[model samples]
Target: MECAGYIDGAFVKGEGARFDVLDPSDESVVAQVTGVSAAQADAAIGAARRAFDSGAWSGLTMKARAAAMTRFGEAMRKRADWLSACAVKEAGCPVSSTVMGAQVHAPLRMTDEIVDLFLRLPEQEANPLPMHERVNPHFAVQSLKRWSPLGVVSAISAYNVPFYTAFWKVVPALMAGDTVILRPNPLTPLSSMIFAEAAVEAGLPPGVMNVIVEPGLAGGLAMTTDPRVDMVSFTGSCAVGASVAAQAAPTLKRLVLELGGKSAQIYLPDAVGRAASAALSVCTSHAGQGCVLGTRVFVPQERKAEVLEGMAALLATVRIGPAGDPATQLGPVISAAQRDRCAHFTRAAVEAGGRVVCGGKRPEGLDQGFYWEPTVLDLPDNSNPAAQEEIFGPVVGVIGYRDLDHAVEMANDSRFGLSGWVHGADRVKALEVGLKIRSGAVNVNGAVMSSYASGGGIKMSGLGRERGIDGLREFQMVTTLTIGG
Candidate 1:
């Protein structure tokens, strides 16, 4: 299937530039997409600017906007199969994961809930003063104004989970009454453009939501630094996020970054079995391409052997194969380059005196795809580069800690603090440990993942949160007003 960019509510071809979208599973050209030029990116930004200024979207009642977004969500759900198939081909995700995307069940439900929250939010209310304690008759009551949209938002998402990440930025920006220009990752652009098509069909105004596919850094920079863009939301590596921050500095544009992570999982002796299962679930999910995976496992020194044994057993059960196979629990890395990178890291870990307890090489018999077996390493210490750096692949570093205090210290040693997990028999102890970990989100005893939880990292991980009420606030600006009797 051929896929094109969506701009100004219409499907359009690029300006004399294009790139092939390869199916990562087999490295075959699945679709051709236009690599939008700077001119096209400027045009997209212009379209979003005009849409925001025209007030066609911003002026609509909250209920009206909510209804429109709901319809768009439904339309996306209707075309879930096409979107999922494209995602599988481009992202090299397991078939089950692709099926989940195609259903649009999670995205739709989350977006719908966000819209409902927006509609139900209370309007700016006036703060009353004490009548008897008024110092002067001129004293007036002040109204606490809620946040309003920041106008046009430039959303640049990564390739790992295209649709989900795009929505993480786009939905919140829209809920805050902003129009958007989305520049999807070059590796996977079709799913985002498909989303734009659904928005147009669902009565989204022209220029309110535009998508452009650009193959390299040029397009991303153009969108981020565009004068017409009011805010920039980016999800990528720390290196790119730093560049984006520097570029947006001169313009002083609002920026939201969800960057890389070297998140850790702490397994107490009492919770070894459960923690081992959770670690496997995270390390194998999306082939460990997620920024929030528990890539670092910190266990007490006394239980190191037991933890490694449990983790190895779990890793052995992982099935790596083509994305569409029902039996496959894991799929190929996003590309050959990613596969090579993972291999390089594994080799480096071995040279650094780390032992590969479970997987250390590519799976057998499936040579066409960019596949790598899930890997777990027992590193000599927490200071090893493999344990500290963000590997962005299916590899986990296991480091033994002397005690609870040492485990917490080890987990907090990384510059990246995106997310962490704690396992303990006592809920209070788990929560206490979670509080000590410096991360955006902490999971205790394999609790449920909440979409409403505020998510983002500290230190080098990134800036700003993407979920919860705080996420909604990030896209908005506040105003205050006072009135006298």
Candidate 2:
């Protein structure tokens, strides 16, 4: 199959080299995409600039923009299966989670879920006071806040959740009236391209939203530094994010980074078994490609044996199958490159005097794809190499802690603070422990009180929030208006 880049208004093939997209499940050729030239990339930015400057999209009212997004959502729903399949093929993950993350969860939240939430945004905000009506003063002045779009958004999305980021960044951006230049990961561009097709069918205006495929990271240099680009919203590793920050620095583009994480799961001594079980499930899910999957598990030093035993037993029962297998509990890693990365993480843990409790190698008899056995390590300390790093694979590490304070201290010690969780008694103690950890979101027990909350990281994890009302504001800038009556 052929994949084309969407620029200005239409899909076109550029006069550049082509690269193959592989199905990670079997290393088969799924589709091939042409590399977008520097000029072609700039053309996309210029097109978005034209759309923004001409007010073709930004001129619409919030309600009108919402309606257009609803239409696009309908169009996207029609292609949901295509996206799910593409993602499963390229991502090498379970079919069910792919369907949920790409087709169902993200699309709904992007359109229907956020419509009323966005509609409730006040046209004018004030630090309300009675002075406006008091004493009949002539020429009374009140300071009010009016929000405006941030013009052009340059979004460089991570490959892990291409379809979700499509909704995460572009939906809020368009609804907030900003034109966008979308640059998805070169390795997994199929699902997002499907979304661009849906947008075209939904009657999105020319240059309103463009999808550009890059052959390599060098192609990203031009996309991030486009002089006309206003803001850069990136989702990837901290190493790459810092480079993006530097690239966007010259233009002083507004930045919103959703970077990597080494999220932790704190198990209070009372909740050791339950917490360890939850941590194991999270770590093993999706082969742990998820940015916020509680990879570092903090268990009490005393209950380490019980926790490790239970975790190992549970891990043994996990059914490993092909990416599309309905009954498969775990699928292959994204690619051979990713699988090697996971291997390196486990090897590093061993070199640092750690031992693998379960699944340290690839499974036997699964030879076609990039599959690795889910491994849990008994690491030396909180600051060990594997414990502190964001491996982005299905490898969990157990670090022993003394008490609640010790757990919180160990949990908060990571440089990347995307997410963490505490498995303990109801809201009171868990809330206390949750507040102490310096992450964007903290889950208590299994309730996920802040699951739908605004999520972004502190420290090296990221810069801006993605969900909730905070996400709506990320694509906007505030303007203070003062008028005298």
Model 2 backbone overlap count = 0
Tens digits of per-residue lDDT, candidate 1, 1-485, equal: 24345778777777737788888788888787667777777788888899999999988877888888888778877877876786678887777763354224567568787887676666565456566533467664545565566789989998888888898888878877899888888888878876687777788988998888877777678777878888899999998899999999888989889999998899876776675675577665788888988889888777777878888888888878888777888888888888898888888888889998888788898889888888888888888878878888888888988887888999999999899989889888888888999998788876444457678888888899987778888887777765555
- Candidate 2 lDDT over residue span 1-485, tens digit each: 35457888888785466888887778888777787877888888899999999988898898888888888777877876777786678766688653346434566445766666678888569746588452255667777789888899988888777777656888788888899888888777777676577678778899998988877765578767878899988999999999999999999988899999998888776676585575457644678888888888888888787788888888888888787888887888778988898889899999999998998888888898888887888987887789989888778898888788988888988899988888876568878899898988777775331214588898999898887789778899888887767
The local lDDT score (0 to 100) that residue 348 gets in candidate 1 is 87
Clashing pairs in 1: none
- Per-candidate TM-scores read 0.95, 0.95
Would you list the C-alpha lDDT of every candidate in the order shown? 0.80, 0.80
Clash totals for all candidate models: 0, 0
Cα displacement (Å) at residue 102, model 2: 5.4
lDDT against true structure, model 1: 0.80
lDDT of 2: 0.80
Model 2 ranges with Cα > 4 A deviation: 97-99, 102-104, 128-139, 447-452
Model 2 TM: 0.95
